[model samples]
Target: MLFAGIDVGSTTSKCVLLSDGEVAGAALVDMGIGTAGPERAYSEALAAAGAAPEDVACCVATGYGRASWKGADLTISELTAHGLGNRFLFPEARTVIDIGGQDAKVIELDAGGRMANFVMNDKCAAGTGRFLEVMAGVLRVPIGELEALAAQAEKAAPISSTCTVFAESEVISQLAAGTPVPDVVAGICVSVASRVAALAKRAGVKEQVCMSGGVARNGGVRRALERALGVPIVWSAQAQLAGALGAALHAWHKSEGQRGEVKYG
Candidate 1:
């Protein structure tokens, strides 16, 4: 049977398809929430899996726009989804650091891979993808190039402002003052890491920490976070699809339960 999961996040949408409890296909779209991104991702995923929507036995939705999707058979919280997904990717993961487009989350997991505690910073964008996007715009650099640019930095410039607007102004000022672009970019990554590190500390960092979400793909931010938290952060190529994959896992479990063949992790 085919099971599907759709994650409609703040700035991206992802879809994952599971065939007989194994990932069959997945797709990610750049647009999200309030847009056609969710449907687009879902359709593309189904197409990739060579299955029609009617072939799906169950569907689950998660993320910021979960409640808005009318196609899902069920909806789950992003925190729970992240925990399950990260654990699936890294069986030893005890903590998960997920930084998305608009928010950051630090989740603690139990020995059984259940979410024990979590701290989220949804009230600000200072440590999120949006913040990095703004900084990139200010520096006239593409967001995707920030990591490579930061790699060349001799020293990271200081950016003390935590507010997005103020930070943007600060970045502009740094440029005006002739601070190297690479240094400023590195500073932005450091600033983001520092803000999220505080949240992770509040949640209590643990060994076998894993990062899941779009921001996890940023090498510069990952390095900065490693330095700030003083621990190795585990990551995978599937990190960005964790939420959707988790939701798909839930869908599979639920579908199996209905058949009286439920399985536990």
Candidate 2:
């Protein structure tokens, strides 16, 4: 049976279609000001899979905006979904660091691949994708170019503040001092990594550390994280879709249980 998972995140909505135990299709779309992002992601994923909504036997929703996705058969927490999905992708992973649009999380998994403990940073945007966007705006640089710019830096400028507003002011001051853009950008990446590293330390990192969410796509952040954690980080092409895939896996498991019940009933 086919199953679907929709993750309605704060900044983007993602959908994953599973044909039995295999991932069939996935899509991601930016969340608009309204509640249309999840619907669009779901439709686009189904279209990519060449399957209709009726073909999906079950659908699970997750993420910050899951409550808005009323069409789902059930809802689960983003932490649960991300833990399951990351475990599926990297069976050896004992720690997960997820930095999404508005928040950052560090999840530790036990030997049995279950969630052991987790910590989250949601009080501010300093360690998240939104923080990078804000800094990009202040630097007049495109968000996509941040990694490349950081790569060119020989020495990163020190950013003393973790507050988003204060960091922006710091960047402005550096620019006023004729500091190179690459140095300032590198400092921003290091600052974000430092913030997230502290959270991971609080949660306790284990072997085979992996990262997820949109921010994981940034090479600069990854490098800084590796330096901060003093370990190599593992990430996959499907990192951003981990939560959605986990939701689909949950739906599949739930569908199996329902089928068993019906047969016995």
Candidate 3:
């Protein structure tokens, strides 16, 4: 059976096409200001998979805009979808840390690879990709360059602020004080990692930790998070596609009318 998943997030939208529980195609695109992202992403994914919408047996939507998606068979929480997606990719993964555009989450998995507990930072942007974007603008550096720039630092400077606006001002002040750009950028990464680490601790981290979402692409944040959590982190080419992949898996499972352990591909 053909199953599809769409994740419409705060900053981007993603879609995945699955055929008999295996990925056939996927698409990711920026989700600007409207609710049209899911449709666009899905259309692209369908084209890539060489399948029409009528060929899909089931479709599931996830992320912040899941409910607003058109023609979705169902909607699931990002937490559940991410846990499933990560476990599907890494069967040994017991902990998951997802840092998306506007929020971050830490999920603990049970022995059977099901989500057991999770903690999230939804009240603030400090632990998210948005925070890094603001800091990058203040540093006059591209967002994609922050990771490499931070890697050049000898020692990370102190950001000292948990608020996004406050942190931007702190960066400005640090620049005025003649602090190196690399050091300041490294400090911003460390600050974000620290906040996410706190959430992971609250959710009870275990071995074989995996990180997902768009922010997981940042090497500086990943390195700092590994240090803060004192664990080796695992990442994959499919990291950014975790939520949509999991939603597709759920759609397949639902089509079978069973709730049991999923056998990985």
Sort by lDDT, top down from the best: 1, 3, 2
Give a tens-digit lDDT track for model 2, residues 197-222.
99999999898999989899899999
Error of 3 at 6 (Å): 0.5
Off by over 4 Å in 3: 32-35, 257-265
The digit string of per-residue lDDT tens for model 3 on 42-142 reads: 99999888889899999999998888887799999999999989998888999999999899999999988989999989689898999998898888789
What digit string (tens of lDDT, one per residue) describes model 1 on residues 1-265? 7888888999999999888656788999999999999999999999888889899989999999999999999999988888877888888999999999999999999887789999999598899999998888888888999999999999999986378998998888999999999999999999999999999999999989999999999999999999999999999888889999889888887878532221221
Ranking by TM-score: 1, 3, 2
* lDDT for position 131 in model 3: 95
Winning candidate number (TM-score): 1
Clashing pairs in 1: none
What is every candidate's alpha-carbon RMSD to the true fold? 2.9, 4.4, 2.0
Q: Which ten residues in a row have the lowest lDDT in candidate 3?
A: 256-265
lDDT of candidate 2 at residue 37, scale 0 to 100: 85
Q: How well does model 3 score by local distance difference test?
A: 0.88
